[model samples]
Target: MKITQKDVEYIAHLARLEVDESLVDKFADQISRILQYIDKLKDADISGAGLMAGASLQNNVFREDTVKVSPGPDVTLANAPERHEDFYTVPRVVG
Candidate 1:
């Protein structure tokens, strides 16, 4: 899991990043430590654990849908800055 200077440079090139020359060594060391930590985590035992959807006990806590009357155009267009009859008007975007 050792990260080299060349590896850092290659990663920077792939990400289209302009990594400073002075920070290459620092970045390489930090990346190496991160990879080592990940390797350590991979070695942990989790065979006894059971996979669950979420941490909470509740599932699908939503209200049931019901058909209702529409509010109509008056309430919908009341706050509009510019309206043309029942439709909203805006500046022309395309020529």
Candidate 2:
């Protein structure tokens, strides 16, 4: 996990960045430490752990479905500011 100045320079070139020459060594050292920390995480033990779950419920649980009839567009759009041809109209939102 040891990063060199050359590696930093190459990464900067690939990213189209204008890294200062004086900061290359600093970046290499910081990257090396970060990679070493990540490498250490690979050794974590989790044999007894289960998949992530909710605090109060288990996975794959669902409620019963119910059916209902729609109240029509008149009731749905009653409070709209503007309407045309069974649809609501608003000012252009995007440029």
Candidate 3:
């Protein structure tokens, strides 16, 4: 679980991080512990377990896609301060 200053520097370079020289030792220790934890996880057994994409067992849970009547064009146009034909018109954003 021991990590060196050189390892920290290398990791920082790979990550494109501007790490402080003083914090290199601390960063190295933290990274080393993370690697050690991963190494420990590799020793555990999970051979027969099914692969799970998410926590819940529910799949394709959705409401039926059906068209329902909302407000008509006239009712929608009434809410708009300005409208052209059946659509709301706004100031041009770009030429």
Among the numbered candidates, top lDDT falls to 1
Query: Is 1 or 3 the stronger prediction by lDDT?
Result: 1
lDDT minimum window of 10 residues, candidate 3: 35-44
Ranked candidates (TM-score, high to low): 1, 3, 2
Model 1: per-residue Cα lDDT at residue 54: 81
Q: TM-score for model 3?
A: 0.46
- Cα lDDT, model 1, residue 57: 92
Q: Report every candidate's CA lDDT.
A: 0.93, 0.88, 0.87
Which residue segments of model 2 deviate by more than 4 Å?
45-95
lDDT string for model 3 (1-95, tens) is 77888988987899998789889989888888888888887777989987888999688789989999988999878888888999899999999
In model 3, pairs of residues that clash are: none
Clashes of each: 0, 0, 0
TM-score of 1: 0.46
Give the alpha carbon lDDT tens digit for every residue of 6-92 in model 2.
989898999999789889889999999999989986788978979665686655778778778988999999988999968999888
The digit string of per-residue lDDT tens for model 1 on 1-95 reads 99999999999999999799999999999999999889986777888988897899997799769988989899999999999999999998899
Winning model by TM-score: 1
Model 3, residue 68: distance off in Å is: 23
Better of 1 and 2 by TM-score: 1
User: Judged by TM-score relative to the true structure, which candidate is superior, 2 or 3?
Assistant: 3
